[model samples]
Target: MATAKDVAARAGTSTAVVSYVFNNGPRGVAPETRERVLRAAAELSYRPNALARALSFGRTLSVGLIVPDIANRFFGELARALEEVAAERGNILLIGDSSQRVEREHEHIAAFVERRVDSVVVVSVSDDPDLSAFADAGIPVVALHPLSESVNASSISIDYRAAAASATRHLLEHGYRSIALFNGPTESAGSRQHRDGFMDAVRDLAPGAAVEEHSTQIARAHAAQVALDMLARPSRPRAVYCATDEQAYGVLFACHRLGLRVPDDVAVTGFDGTEHSAYSYPPLTTVRQPIPEMAERAIALLAAGEERVRETVDFTLAVRESCGRHGTDVAS
Candidate 1:
């Protein structure tokens, strides 16, 4: 409970000088006096009130980030990239995990607004999240997922449909006669795009090949459980394309438990190509999202004083061991 008064007393300065030093204010202090004040504050364990400073200065020099699930690898990577960018810009990043709950997302949003964060980045659970609160508070927000046009926030995301189709087309190129789509459970805008791209690829491959759809939560354990049951059946798919790396890893585990060799007995592809995908038992073939680039763009957009604009980035398909060789050999 040490206050600025105690530090000012120890530093032989008035509280006004301490305030000016802490807030970097209208009045300038000599370097020696600033060092003395900082040393006294450190010795006395004195802390300044962030709220009062923000109320006066209109910025906390911080950015808030709300993600659906911080445990998910894709969001984890995004958070890390954003942190790096924020640090370079002399801003701190505060992470808030919604844990896939809309109420929790709202709670974080309200808290960030009350705390007066300079801006926010969110990956909301709902397709149409309540962004008006932040908009009213004049806090800029950027979403990392597909958002509706009416959401009134800047968005930076890769074309999920095209990425899904590209990965599916890669599977088709391998001539996997029976392909499966392991997609997200909810039929949100993102999931719909994934389905659209997947179906587009299937239709282009045409009537000769068979396609099936499977749904699971975006977690490794859940996806593994679902994949295990599906792969246990006699008519299991020859190749599976998962919407996320977590689901893809789960499918890989299911293949191992079922004694089905990957890219031999059954091939698999994954989206959201995180770094860990390369280290999976068999390096996975996945659609690589430009995470660093996306992070930079999203932060820049949120920092910029411009009208809301939605932008879509491109994704790259990383062909690897799990998708099998790219030769003319047809899948069994």
Candidate 2:
């Protein structure tokens, strides 16, 4: 309720001096004068107009984040890390969940453009998500997943194919000849990479291995429903390699419902090794994407205001109890 004029009147300084103090100024104020303005503001509980300052400076000091599935633990972790990085640079983060819908994603895109956010980071449901709205609005955008060449945006992620291959090979090494791959909902670039990596690993390591692929929405419940039927069959897979930690958890639930023990009746592996994965029943053998490092890099890149850059972060295969291992050690 207190205005700058009120504080200025109390401080015996002009409103321009208050502006200089609050904005850190186009013109410098003396230390004594600055102290008087601050004291007066504290007495009157004066607040500056952030929107007015942003309008004048052409920066909202906020970052927009769009995630495909907010309920998925992986995305939640990514958002948390991104939020921290954004906050460190004095930027508030605005999150939009698309729920794996392109229309929802586009709505968020349009909203971010309209808000005039300083930058945007997205994990789109589509490989070639149309970001022209943000592009036309001159807002720099980055994708956390691989994007098609036509998308016109920067991307930073682990090599999905390589990460998938690495996890699949680990399952193969444990001698899982009859394996199944649980993938994301569609045949997007990321899903294809996962499928390719899975098949490639099977071909190279276990040429005669039996393999099948199943697609489901990137959620625990949907994946569980699909797995419950497949896992109940007489010729169920000896092991399952999931494209996400969420799906892997679903398969674990299915196995539990069927009274099958993990790494004994069947082995399992997952991608996106979220922190909670470590506490799963048998623990989770997974590929750990560096969410914090990737988030830091993405935020820093946008803050740098340079040409958008394409970069690949590293991933590790975290060996744990979910997949049968040779030793008691549980580490990458």
Candidate 1, residue 46: the lDDT equals 88
Worst 10 residues of 2 by lDDT: 323-332
lDDT of 2 by residue, 71-187 (tens): 889889999999999998989999999978889989999888888999999998876678888889989988988877778789998889888988899989888899999999674
| Over 4 Å off, model 2 | 187-189, 326-332
lDDT score, residue 160, model 1?
87
Kindly state the number of residue pairs that clash in model 2: 0
Best by lDDT: 2
In candidate 1, which residue ranges exceed 4 Å CA deviation? 10-12, 29-47, 326-332
Taken over the whole model, the C-alpha lDDT of each candidate is 0.88, 0.89
- Pick the TM-score winner: 2
